[model samples]
Target: MSRRHLAMLTATVLAAASLTACGSGDEPGDGGKTLTYWASNQGASLEADKEILQPELDKFEQQTGIKVNVEVVPWSDLLNRLLAAATTGQGPDVVNIGNTWSASLQATGALVEFDDATLDKVGGKDRFVPAALAAAGAPDKPPAAVPLYSLAYALYYNKQSFADAGITAPPTTWEEMAEAGRKLTGDGKWGLAVEGANPSENAHHAFTFAQQYGGEWFDAAGKPTFDTPQNVAAVKRYVDLMAVDKIVNPSNAEYAQNQSVSDFANGKAAMLLWQAAGANLKSQNMAADAYGVAPVPFLANPPAGGKQVNSMVAGINIAVFKHTKNLDGALEFVKFMTSDTEQVTLNKTYGSLPAVGTVAADPAFAADEQKVLAQTLATTAAPLPQVPEESTFETLVGTAIKELFADAASGRPVTEDSVREKLTRAQQQMR
Candidate 1:
């Protein structure tokens, strides 16, 4: 996270528990127990989150006679604030966190233990995506946090580019994708926008390919396997897209997570892999009619044993602080946030899908594009490692991966040995 984000988060921790920020012995009806809330910016605009939530908080206040003070934090500031709050014991009453961060934050003992009671309040464990809840909640236990929504990935390619290239269909296999890429590469165009400098994207593509190649990042127990030959070969092919094949662009040296999306949107790239939000299809910015969705391209003749895995999963969960002075108030708010009606409303307005299957299955939410994202999540998503150490690489590893791919693309002589050495070193650092 950036220093500015960390600073803002630190301020939030102070505001949440500083007897002053909660409102000094004010003249409120109650003796002043302001349940401070800190949330992420996943809801598009911060104003939107308030417009949707203020009514709920107002309702909660009216019904239960409790006051809630809320502050919206951007994604970058979330971890910093959480870290500050956790270390100081003066944070928001409730926190909205990335599901993948459960292990890291849980380690700090900053959150309450999820239980049968909360499970029922949040529509039960069965209500959420199994993979999501697995990542959101504590392992070997019910989730400490309730599922909010999922951010899913898909292949978003340029229809015009595909047409101009005389390609009528998207590739279903890695081989076909490569062949199609070769067909599409010419002049100023390239087949794929592979950023070897982006470790995060590389990691994501690695996971996506490992499935298509029939391997995974970890066994059932959650261990590193990126160095394995399947993954190594998978990484090789991704590198080869730039190295040997030369179907990827050189701009990838500077590409980040969603950089390729811009390239595809602007027609500079024929294919771009990214997290897809169908709700944005009709927006003025997106080429909705010119694009379509598909499961990621797979391997043609898997080495006879690889599995076809889909995209990785990401989302936020609401967690109650373990040390909140007001448990009753916190639980009350939790119930309000996870209610069936609340789920529908939040998903519709936030572009986030309901955590529970029932909520998505509801006639009310059926119209929302977020529901489609949720369905894609249910059947195809792979859970990223819940370990916090992985979160540390959100940027660093991505930078490394992007550089590695870019270096190879420029014929600067990056080799598997060098990349693997770094990756292996990273895994060891986690330990």
Candidate 2:
């Protein structure tokens, strides 16, 4: 299937905590004649996605007279395929990847540097959210990948839970959120929601919370910064919500991408923290008019210099592999995919918050739900550190946080100092 389809299906089938990378080159393709490009499981399968995406591919063939040999690999297999290809130079000519992979993949020197002039031929940075583009960039270098689509974290709440808790509206601060959560708890329901198992989601959510608490994951040099005073303090405070506050779901110890969203959607929880509100709510077919989405709650006491950092910014990025024999043809395909025309088509076929600024303004993503998302991506965005060590750090931090939550769920006394000690252990591994 297509990448978008894979994204949705993977939500139900795969744990959000994953390590799927694309474009390995360890072994070669069947015959070296075709420009074999591999992509992720966007929908049902490669063949299924071809129904929507293959037409686009066909158009490219007609326009450029370049035949693309396409392979659809499951997200589960993407990392292995890319590793194989990277080792053997047998990766695809074009690939779509999670924004988080930019740092790790780039560090291996497996991809080529993105050129500004060339990117302009594709969709320019002006077309995408600054932070989304930034995620695909080097610390001080220009972006390496062209974002194909984007998402931003927002607060999705169950109206029933809010009403039951006597909450007129969603909480506006972490302290107030805790109070609301407690009120919503009991009666076989959870107040707050989480993706505890998946570091892909957890680390970002933690980072977003850290921003509100005035924390940074990496220092100026892009080294591990989880041990920073602010980060440590923020993490301890966050973990306490489940461990000490007792407002979160105990089962959250193993949540992933859409799990929390599912909780809120099904009315099992009061709130879900995530990006891609509309797509994730999975409420498209269901009549969830009772659902309400809003910006993340602000911190009660503002950090000295930190603004209210709400949600993590994320997106799908498009990159042209260096080894594609059809350089000019591949370039044309890239331009077509990112162009305003293609963006419009993509939004309809697979609904995502679009990456291009103009397309975001289009009527397709026009509902109040989508409007707020676009705004978040444009203004509230804070790019996660674009460094290779980031994913590794997330895995370490996530495990500790999960343990803390488990302790809290069992009514154990969890302390900031204890979390700090855990951070120390994580720091050692990260380094």
* Model 2, span 155-262: residue lDDT tens: 778877688778998887888888888998998998888876665565776788788878887787767767677777777777767876778887887664456767
Off by over 4 Å in 2: 1-88, 123-131, 348-351, 409-412
Q: What TM-score against the true fold does each predicted structure earn?
A: 0.77, 0.81
Runs in model 1 deviating more than 4 A are 1-33, 43-72, 129-131, 182-202, 218-223, 239-249, 256-259, 280-284, 349-352, 363-378, 386-399, 406-411
Cα RMSD to the true fold for all candidates: 5.4, 6.4
Across 322-388, the per-residue lDDT of candidate 1 in tens digits comes to 7677776787787778777777877666556677666666765554244445666767777766654
Give the C-alpha lDDT of model 2: 0.67
Please give the distance, in angstroms, between residue 302's alpha carbon in candidate 2 and its true position after superposition: 2.5
lDDT by candidate, in order shown? 0.66, 0.67
lDDT of 2 at 391: 51
